[model samples]
Target: MSELEEAPPESGSLAELARKYGLRPAIARPRPGVYLRQLWERRHFILTYATSRNVSRYSGSALGQLWQVVTPLLNAAIYYVMFGLILGGSRHIDNYPAFLLTGMFVFTYTQRVVTSGAKSISGNLSLIRALHFPRASLPLAYTLQELQQLGVSMAVLVLIVMLTGELPTWSWLMVPVVLLLQTSFNVGAGLVMARLGASVRDLNQLLPFIMRTWLYASGVFFAIHDKVVVSAGLPEWVATVMYLNPGAAFIEWMRDLLIGSHDLPRTVWVACVFWAVFALIFGFWYFWRAEDRYGRG
Candidate 1:
């Protein structure tokens, strides 16, 4: 047989040839440290991509980006009617409108970040396959975009809080602290969901139901303590478990800052810090574990 015919498989030879030439697989996953450095290097690209998405997100609508503020406000109104007034969820709460609005604004930030992050990869298949940048950038950009939208919603939240007779206090200074923690948790959560979403095509369909359930269970429209403790008569630990939920924890923390009548347990802040660190660490490792598989067919 000819030397070519007698040769081993081309695949093995090609791999050896690539190694000899300092080449790697097209989708080769980088080491964790390398991946993080790559992500940092592309930070500007991530920011610009996120900003473009925010600009285009509502470009077609007449109201444009105002919907960012209006969508949550409208949800607050609907929730107010259904749960606050009709269901009497606002009875125990002081400044029920502001309370409900605060919950929606805070929870919705995480909600949008997760939802968009899940779709970030699948929705941008072209980009993923066309480029070799860190896959984590997609989720990070989506989270930043949602944070931008939340900024508008936050201004409205403060105004409404004041209108409802909540005067600003020293507690308000903690707003950024709460937001920073929540954003950290969101980044990790988004990274995880991005990996899951790229693998599971059906996850997108279930997210809305999941988010709606989370919204109701999070005490977005009612006082978590009043409903879970006073009304449900569940054990203290049960209420604590609910308070420990990342979504509930952030919303309660924000409420404490923005609503004067809202008081929270010290454990809520602990939960916030714990979840932020845990999710970020776990999510990064988890998502990075499957990095090479992200854009595969």
Candidate 2:
């Protein structure tokens, strides 16, 4: 028999078995592939735009990227006065400014992901029609931009905490873990919205309303404590609802880690993990299903 025919069936079966059991297959072995040529062709353009975004934001102005820091500070001040001082979140949170800033920063990342991703493909229509790349990259770029913003915001937050006497303990190391979970959720949700926005287009208009509703529901303007008593004394269901909100969970989890609070519960962590995994899988699958349509005018 020829060498190919003489080879034992067990060798091939064993290799397949190894793959089935989650072993990494050698790259030389052909595997089911994505559209590599398309990805490669468009990667340079995407990277060039991404780099240009980073550079242009800091190129001309004296303050440069300091605007990122300044913008959030101004936002915090406005919200602190409007909500914490006049409208009264101070009654709930001990340090209302800190709490509001944390909530605002975290929730803003989610909002950025949702809003920008929703317009990613549609907003880049000229490039989309001319280039044959993964439409997913548009949303991915938005997510990275938000992540860059988050890094700057978090640094400012750390300085604020230090000045305010909320010194970091070893527990603060959990910030990255919390951030990773949060990013996973954002990426998944953004992917879904990217496709939906491209297909429906009207979703672009509704996104801001959705974000506004989410902001209110997320407890950014209030505390998640059981301070409000029910008329029928229904117990703490409102607080439960707040904890269940993904935005609230992310913010509170960050607070627990960054501000050294113990208010977040195990259930919140579990729920966040569940949503992160579900969103990532579901969103990517749906986006890939429509891959062929992304480059069409």
Candidate 3:
């Protein structure tokens, strides 16, 4: 007989019985090689599954993908009224609507990743428990769905710009590069949230409010540069903290490309790229550390 079969029953627990002899727990050691290979072998399965989910989820509605455009337009209108008309802000920034919309678009991508990743494992608990594939794939597939949607949103923005007389410039070509960095940042944050929020459900609820604060502090709806540089009483540490925000780096880099006669320091672009890479590495490690636990309830 095998060592496990020959083991003596000890105490009341199966774990104790197994441990009393020489048997190890079944779930304790998953086949990492098989797990990774399963992910690669089922790439097509993942792609098709993710695509169908995106389509059915959005297309089931009456208006269909029209909500994509409607959602942002409504957001822009609200911000215009609150920050532009009532408070009479954005006077310091040129093409306020365009500026606000660009930042919102970028921020929305990250927000989607964070919120969705946070709920991915919990929402698909059955799949996680039953399936033997990499848990990382769950968060990754969710991020991919958002990326597809973001592409549609970007196309809408391009059309809006054309109608509003914002012609594409040579600098517009740099958009894809900036977008790549933004996506990297999202993937990183998404992966981290998947594990963190799975361990603690509270992270999911707290993320949105944190993101809203991040949005305002990012200088999307207003210019904080002059406030940072010229205000004599402002502490240097405060300005440094503002500069460290990844959203702020992304917004400033985007404005340099989108707005004419405006340019950001090279360091800003470097900062965005740096943080994007940083987030990706940190998030991947954080998520992977709990790989085995993810399948547990």
Candidate 4:
């Protein structure tokens, strides 16, 4: 009978016993702290990926890197014509160009990060399957790519602000702080979207519509505070909620810094900090929970 039951029990080594029972080392989920440490260890890879993406994004195009600046400028021009000129969105607003550009630039950063993050997982399935690195690196890399693009775009925005007669001032120093808060929010958003998109591939198709709606709601084309709150006589709580919107808060903060608009309300600052922290903590935990399932069918 098959070499007398395959051998003596004493000769069964641990590996043989494991194979006989179809048992192997348990693939326990990593502890959160360990996962984070692993992610930190891969920070250089993340940065390199981000830098590579930023540099190569327009490599095939005739203008190459100029498209980054041109894309947003084109959008700004279209919005200026449609909303500013045709719809009178800029009515009663001084320095409308700077106002619109600041909002567009700030909000675009979040939009790009989210859209790119959504694609990060689904688009890199092959790499995920082949590599043993942390999956969070994908979304983080995309966020950093968008952040690099934002840095370039901000230079163009600053020039636009100056040309529109809004000189740089001490308030301009606050721009980096606002950008940092928004970057944190974008990272969290990217993580959440990466997980969601992997599970529901249709999310990529729907993100553009969602982001478009968000853009309008974010006061990118008009002054929500002046046009809606002051003119519509909306209740105070509603205004508070609108101002607290992370997108609107960021856009308004940039406007204040770039155009000498009214100081951002204390509540807006609180809201920015709150959203940044909340999104990051929740997003990371949510994403980490699904780590083992990332590449599975």
Candidate 5:
């Protein structure tokens, strides 16, 4: 046989040997711990990106960052008019403006995070292609951006609550705890939407409607406990399920802390903790699974 034909089989065994000896893939999927460490190492970049984006968002607006507070305030006014006055949804609630605005501010934070995160990866294609940082940074930075805006809006919310005759109490200390849990939940939601939006471009369009439905169902403008559970005569289990909604749970926690609402179910606390932990774990794994595919298209 010719020398070429006499050579050892270069197809299967040799290919395996070559692969075994070759340099490791530059973009191979990382172990979970390693991936998390990489993300932590890049935290500064995430913060800087978040800060810059937050500033730039309002750079052109006439009122600048004031719009953050004003936008939600406007929504609260409309809801107050429609749901509180026109629809009589606030008939059973005391200090309906405080209750309505509390829910609006808290819920809007998550809404913005989810919607912005859905576009984080797809919107930052250029940055993803140009940078070697962890892809998680995009969603993380976006969430941080929303968190900062929420912080500003929250200051205004506190003043609004004061104006509505709700004064600070010892229970207000729990605000930080609730905020921590909700931030965890928001980050996870953002990560999940980032992956989904990267794969399904239409998700960006669908999120607004989905969030609106979620807002109403979350009892933003009315007392869900009174309307759904007590007045409507929902079954115990059904009311329990509604109380378990993460959005409503967070809002309930805030109302309890800020407005002295004493009707919060203990189960809402459990649901808040469960959703925060579950979402973070599942969302991180889900987003990391497709890390290598992010910028391919």
Candidate 6:
């Protein structure tokens, strides 16, 4: 054979050619470790993105950022009248206003993270196709945005709690811990929602109903044990299951912390830790598994 003769014209498919050249698809799925590292590397970008979105979120409104605190307060007021008064939710609880508001603000954080996350991937098709960064960043940023907004809401919550006659105590120090746990859960769940929202056509439409059902079940407007186990005479385990729900777990924890009279058993803390770990692990893996298919048909 002639030395100049090309080595049998390098045969096989384009994939083989790519393999031979040490090349990979531009949008190829990365290993789990690599994907997470990528996300960590882009932390600053995610923060900036989230901050920008949050700033722009209510910028168009006449009231501007004041709406952050106002929106949840108004929602709480409506729920107070409807559920606390009309439906008799305040019957067995002392300082029902604080209880109701705590639940509302806490649950709203999760709801917005999920609802926005569900649209993160689908709604950012242009951005996804145009860029090569980790898709998880979008949902993570949305989570951060909600978290920042929650900071403002938290200040207002403290004011309202005091106005409703609750005294601050040493237990209040644990507020950040509860938030850290719920944020973990939200991050995980948001990733899951981001992936699903990207693929499911009707998910956006169904999200409102799902969120509403979650709100009702999470003891947002009333006490779970009082309403379910005592009033309805349902099984104790029924209320237990509701407490185990991540949203309920976080909300209850917040209520217990902010409202001194609202005491709960040790199990709710366990639920918080459990859901935080479970959701983060499962949601991250599930979303990463579908990484390569995000923007394509």
Q: Which candidate gets the maximum TM-score versus the true structure?
A: 1
Q: Candidate 4: give its CA RMSD in angstroms.
A: 3.9
Q: List model 1 lDDT by residue over 1-297, tens digit each.
A: 876576565888888898899997778888999899999999999999999999999999999999999989999999899998898888888889988888989998999999998998999999988888999999999999998888888888899889999998998998989999999999999999999999999999999999988987787888777787889898888888889989999999999888877889789999999999999999999999999998888
Measured over all alpha carbons after superposition, the RMSD of each candidate to the real structure, in angstroms, is 1.7, 10.2, 4.3, 3.9, 2.7, 3.3
Please provide, for model 5 over 1-297, each residue's C-alpha lDDT reduced to its tens digit, 9 standing for 90 to 100: 776676677668776886889945566779899999999999999999999998999999899989999999999999999989999988888889999999999999999999999999999899888877789999999999998888888888999898989888988888989999999999999999999999997987888899999998898987776787788888777767877999899998888889875478889999999999999999999999999899886
Between the candidate structures 3 and 4, which one is better when assessed by TM-score?
4
Worst 10 residues of 3 by lDDT: 25-34
Candidate 5 lDDT (Cα, 0 to 1): 0.89
Q: Can you write out model 3's per-residue Cα lDDT over 1-297, one digit (the tens) per residue?
A: 776586665557777767789897544534556656766887777677678778887677898867766787788889889987787677766777777787777777777788888988878889878866678788888888888888988887777655655778998999889889988888888888888878886886788798889888887676666556554467766666776688888878777787674558556788888988998888877777777787575
Candidate 2 global CA lDDT score: 0.76
Q: What's the lDDT for residue 70 in model 3?
A: 72
Ranking by TM-score: 1, 6, 5, 4, 3, 2
CA deviation > 4 Å runs, candidate 5: 1-18
* Candidate 1 vs candidate 4, TM-score winner: 1
TM-score of each: 0.95, 0.80, 0.85, 0.90, 0.93, 0.94
Which whole-number lDDT from 0 to 100 does residue 197 have in model 5?
96
By the lDDT metric, which is better: model 4 or model 5? 5
Candidate 6 lDDT over 171-272, as tens digits, reads 999999999999999999999999999989999999999999999889988888988988999999999999988889999989989887897857899999
User: For each candidate, how many residue pairs have backbone atoms clashing (under 3 Å)?
Assistant: 0, 0, 0, 0, 0, 0
C-alpha lDDT values of all predictions = 0.90, 0.76, 0.77, 0.88, 0.89, 0.92
Question: How displaced is residue 234 in candidate 2, in Å?
Answer: 5.1
Error of 4 at 278 (Å): 0.9
- Least well predicted 10-residue stretch by lDDT in candidate 4: 3-12
In model 6, which runs have C-alpha deviations exceeding 4 angstroms? 1-12
User: Which regions of candidate 1 deviate over 4 angstroms?
Assistant: 1-21
- Pick by TM-score: 1 or 2, better one: 1
lDDT of 6: 0.92
Better of 1 and 4 by lDDT: 1
